[model samples]
Target: MGRKEFYWYYKLHATTAIFPTRSDGKLSKYKHLGKAGSQTYIDAIEQITARTRIEALDRSIEALRQGLKDLVEETSKYNKE
Candidate 1:
């Protein structure tokens, strides 16, 4: 299908491409890249996506660990025979 939308203009654009600001306050573009550049552009996008996912998971795991630790500490305070 034709380009229904555009994002990451800064990451993937031709050397001669120009994105101008439109009068309607929407972003305007002059050119889009074909499948002509080196594979590094796509590789970078994948790496960035993976890194973001890993970071989010790490934060979630740490939060769960802290919650469990707090629960154990509170339970240990109960009197025992």
Candidate 2:
């Protein structure tokens, strides 16, 4: 198994309900049936990374939204006074 095969298997599993991902993020037993088991433990750090990027992005978006809201409210108050 190689990086290419693992990616292919990953894509295949994502498309179909055949091979399931385990709680540990590894492929299920059925994955070996396709002969991709050899690359199960391998990872691809070049093209992808699984970390807190999504969480950080969400927090940034929320902060921006709240800041915009606060600005709008303060401007409206100043206009009235």
Candidate 3:
């Protein structure tokens, strides 16, 4: 997908979280991480990383399949002659 499409996709499905506020009523810098830290943040990071790796593997598999298909066609043509 293009940048704009991916941006909208995430924007539509993104989760919302409320963080603790400061004395002045400003939002915390570590909004997602939370005050004392959170397992959710770690899990989210891991999940995203795993998804990226899976996508890379899927692309690699498709490329390999295409290469093998091309090689088979070439070999068949050579044998016919």
Q: Give the alpha carbon lDDT tens digit for every residue of 1-81 in model 2.
A: 556543334332234444556566655534432333434424322223453666778899999999999999999999999
Residue 19, candidate 3: C-alpha displacement in angstroms: 18
* Candidate 1 off by > 4 Å: 1-38, 79-81
Report RMSD for candidate 2: 10.8
Model 3, position 4, has a per-residue lDDT of: 57
Task: For candidate 1, write residues 22-75 as lDDT tens digits.
Answer: 455545444233343436556656766999999999999999999999988888
Worst 10 residues of 2 by lDDT: 39-48
Which whole-number lDDT from 0 to 100 does residue 25 have in model 3? 62
Clashing pairs in 3: none
Runs in model 2 with CA error above 4 Å?
A: 1-51
Per-residue error at 18 for model 2, in Å? Answer: 13
Q: For residues 1-81, what per-residue lDDT tens digits would candidate 3 score against the true structure? A: 556542111111234433445566654434343322356556656777999999999999999999999999999999999
Sort by TM-score, best first.
3, 1, 2
Estimated TM-score for each candidate: 0.49, 0.42, 0.55
lDDT of each: 0.63, 0.56, 0.63
